[model samples]
Target: MTSAQPSGEIFELQADPEVVDKAALEGQLPGSPLSMHRVAKGHFRVVVSGLRTDAMLRYRFRVHRKDLGRWIQVSDPFAWQLDASRQRWSTRAIGLEDATRKKARPLPRRPTFDQLVIYELCPREVVPKATRYADLVTAPTGAQPRFGSIFRAITRRIRSGYYDQLGVTALELMPILAQGWRRATPQGVGRPFESPTERPPWGYQAMSWYAVNGDYGTAAELVELIDAAHARGLAVLADVSLEHGYGGKENGLVTDLWPRWRVPRPKNRWGLLELDLAAPGAFPFVVGGLRRLLVDLGFDGLRLDWTEKVPPKTWKRVVAEVRRFAPEAILISENPTLPLITEAGFDGTWDFFFHWEAPLLLRRVYRNWDGLAKRLVSTQRKLVENLEGRAYPPHGAKRVAGIDPAKGPPVVRYLESHDLPRVARRRVRWQHGGGHLMDVDGDGKTPDWLNHGSQATSRLGATLLATLPGAILLFQGQEHGADDELIWAHDPLESRRDAKTFGHYQRLLKLRARLPVLRQNDLRVLLSDDKRHVLAYSRGEDPARGDDDRIVVVLNFAPQAVRRLRIPMPSPGRWRDLLGGKTYPCGKELTLHLPLAGSLLLQKLGKRQTLGKRQTLGKRQTLGKRQTRAKTKDCEPARYARHASKPVSTSR
Candidate 1:
């Protein structure tokens, strides 16, 4: 790897390799020979990438930096840990007695938004299926999964910090409720389906929500996975279907002992029995099961699947119950269709429409730029307007429409997931019209649907997503420009062999993380049109202070036209195109001659501009004058009365 310092110059100096080989697992990354290589002259950071860890897995790495500067270790790895040795990182098992013995010391807190990149990885490139309780010994197509078992090989690159270069938060793992997929997994290994049973790939038709698919891991192993992730500053969110459950293959305790409480449903996709969310006498059975599975699972939150289908009363009760056992526990509904959950409820909701629909809308620039802009402005405006005076849905209903609180919690915005077909293979792109020439990879000259301008638009899409009024989300390889859409299957993020795609992600994420205004909720659409294939939007905290606290986002979907646009200059200094890392000077009126399919996130340094060069209120003078004014303003109240006719709100 060409070592480039943060300054974009060749890195100087060299450091010894940072190694972590403490992992132990059957067919795990068998220890590799420690090959010492001198970094090519001028290269600085040598990334020894891909370090893997699971629940309870212990990994040991030795570090010897040549200069010995304070090394800042950052990774969104498995939730493992640095042991008491500080140098030796490992996952420790907690026992009642052991925990009490170490009561004086607590485990480190998991990484949060500030330190990690979370991603919703797409699995469409891989086979689509729900998580199983047994081990994933084979792929959906029956090919042996090689790197899937090599955690260290895969994660080593991540630990080396290259993934950060690819935009991501934490990787969101879909449901691996492998209660019955064991027939594919070999015996004597972790068996989610030890004896064999019926199951469905999408785990939403739940059998036992409390039980972790044995295929995924045992309770102890899950602990290791969590600990490893924490060591990397990454946290995990699990797929939880609270609205319903499968009764066929149930929890050992629930099915065998409490079968009477569940209602059998033989006709659904899973054909397994399901719990009655609204039924009488079954509420405790359901709650008890969830409380046990979720409260103690050491998960960050539940991606409640098919949430709209659940009963709001039941959801509220479930949340209320989880809080009793674990106050910090969070639950987010899947594809909520109602008003987004906010303050005192769900943390956030996914923005499926933005990614799913934005691509088609942006594609309009291939024809009329003005018409496209108008269309965009209309669509966005309608949503912004429609949300007004609308009541938020009950927790259960919010699960379907995917809107979470638009005001409080950041809504989770995503373009793809397990249920949706890979965007690349989309059967039909709605009514807007995607031509046959779009099949770019089918041995043809024309662009394929997957790699069309839409392909490139997906990159710009991430910038838009991060700049939206919600929590940013990227389905695994989308950052890498992976051509595959999300299919219901195992192994999404780095599931396949393409590593180059993530290169774009690294830059996109750094832009989003470095810019604060993009994360703020103050939003305004400066331009929106579908025909011209251009959509311009602005985001900021306060327009008054927004001179520098603002960002101008422009997307040009046109493939040929060099669209010249009169754009707003957020500030008076230089406007830099964040995407290309290029700068352009501007004031008041800003013009852009964008390349075909080009998009821009322009940030201008705030000028210390004030009306007629008024003095920047010095700290002492500013506060002191205010104090003196309260006591010394002569006839302050009389002056106020004289201006009564001119009284006005200062917001102007």
Candidate 2:
């Protein structure tokens, strides 16, 4: 194994052509997957693409050390011995340093930087049909969400300055595996297979888990995408729905090949395609296929959707087998109910506590503040205990290294996801209450669902999601104020331009990624929730990093205002609003100029992993001439004089 050079830089991996040439002549390394290209006389480069990176900034490098007969894993993504003229290699922001001795090293598991923010976007849910590339919904026009067409589009996003641009470190994609899709039409879209007049592009109703959907791109395309992501410094995770499958729809597959495959055709409309993990051959076919797919493709982690539904015992075996294929694979289970799953083998379970349950409780329509707090307490206690396994602890919970009280797998927290009513839909549903689905008014203007429900909550939710500890998963457009509920319908691409939620989301993403405390798992408990009027909590290592240290978070959820906001902390310093760089008073109590209770982002005032890389940002492209002029006024003075201000004092 080889170590990457320096921390926080991007290094690439190239096949040693000299060695490859020798091997090619003698037949050691395979030609189909591995290739070498020439550089200068003395050195050759083999660029390995499709590696995942995080804010920690690590590169995956492979090398062959003569000392060790077998090939060795290198520290950096790209490596070369005695390449003195390599300026590019020396100037990257990677933490993994190059070896001076030119000896092979093993790749390490820990990230150089501790904070990693993985954004989740069910592509079809976020990007609307008929949405043109330019019709980005923001009135002022902001940055576009880094979305991809091919699997590589994701890599391009990681490298293209999207996540990097947005300040997000790692990236997570909803199932890229085979999801049957069709053009939105009146009949319906995807597996339900409706007329063009009846479809929506939401991919929840999937078809096959083994094959990568053609619309999203091919398997090779996916590989290229992952490799590109790694180069861009992103740690990638594949979200797999191990709980159920698309079995039993008009669902037709070659079951005989996988004799255990069960496609049940239930009588009910909402009937799911469930698998009996207890069944024979069923476990392997279910587990093996995905395990093989992930290892073959090489992803950084796995997000198991709804592991709660899967029997715990069965899930244990599945996880054990998955580790055999890729041990460094981060296991994240999206089970809202089973906080205990963290001990079963999962690195963490989705803290639906923060994502939905807690929020819903804060909303007051569902659960009360006490109810929410109790739920948190109940689950947290159960999770705190380590269930002894035959080998190690039962996958209940294990405190992470370097993070005290950070004992649980990360809680995947979110505001708006592919499921549920759009943020706006929820609001509208609460207030005026109308559509089962959003409908254009007779005047042709879109419904106010986005502005009221989806739009408002989205902005607020983003702020809160970023402030919460554990992990924050960004759904597409939530930052930009997505107005549409992620409901699937069969129609032409009509809704794309209507939703203008990308800019806010992009801002939110960068904020969340910059804060390390929000990424740490500890008790970010919400206090003083009188009938869900205000949502508040504390996150991070509180007693202090060496001793359970953390930052306190308090929110005034009342849509009106909160002149005084009180949060619990051992003591306080000036609390800074990480969102707009605003600072709030600290001590026993703090006051907040509350806009609404839906959401926000806050960090304790102190030195931490700073936000996005500091750069003289280029002029942000404005949408209209008026906005452009405003931007010019804002950016020109800084841009021109800074470059022009250099004095010609060369007389010395």
* Backbone Cα, N, C clashes tallied per candidate: 105, 110
RMSD of each: 20.2, 19.9
**Which ranges of candidate 1 are over 4 A from the true structure?**
1-117, 121-167, 182-202, 247-256, 264-272, 278-281, 288-295, 339-344, 362-409, 423-455, 485-501, 570-573, 608-652
Alpha-carbon TM-score of each model against the true structure: 0.60, 0.56
Q: In model 2, which regions exceed 4 Å deviation? A: 1-116, 124-159, 179-207, 248-252, 256-269, 278-280, 339-343, 358-409, 424-456, 488-512, 522-532, 535-550, 564-576, 580-588, 591-593, 597-652
Whole-model lDDT values for every prediction: 0.42, 0.43
The true-structure Cα RMSD of candidate 1 reads 20.2
What does the lDDT come to for candidate 2? 0.43
Cα lDDT tens digits, model 1, 1-652, are: 1122343311122221232211111111234322223444312332222333222323322222333333222110122121211111222222222211221111255433333345653222222233232233322211222212122222443455544446554656565442333221111112343221233344443344444443333344444454455455565666665535444331221332233445553334334455565554466655654554444545665667656655565566777877887565445666545432432256666654444445544444132111212322333333332222122342123433443344423456555444433333324332211122232122334442432434455555555556665466665556555554333234444444344335555666676677766666566666655445566777775556556756788876555554346655444445556767755544344555666556778765546422111111222222223232111111112111111233222110
Candidate 2 per-residue lDDT, tens place, 375-493, comes to: 32322222112111111122334543322343433455565555544454445432111132322122323442322343555556556566654556665544445455444531112
Model 2 — TM-score against the truth?
0.56
Query: Where does the lowest 10-residue lDDT sum fall in candidate 2?
Result: 82-91
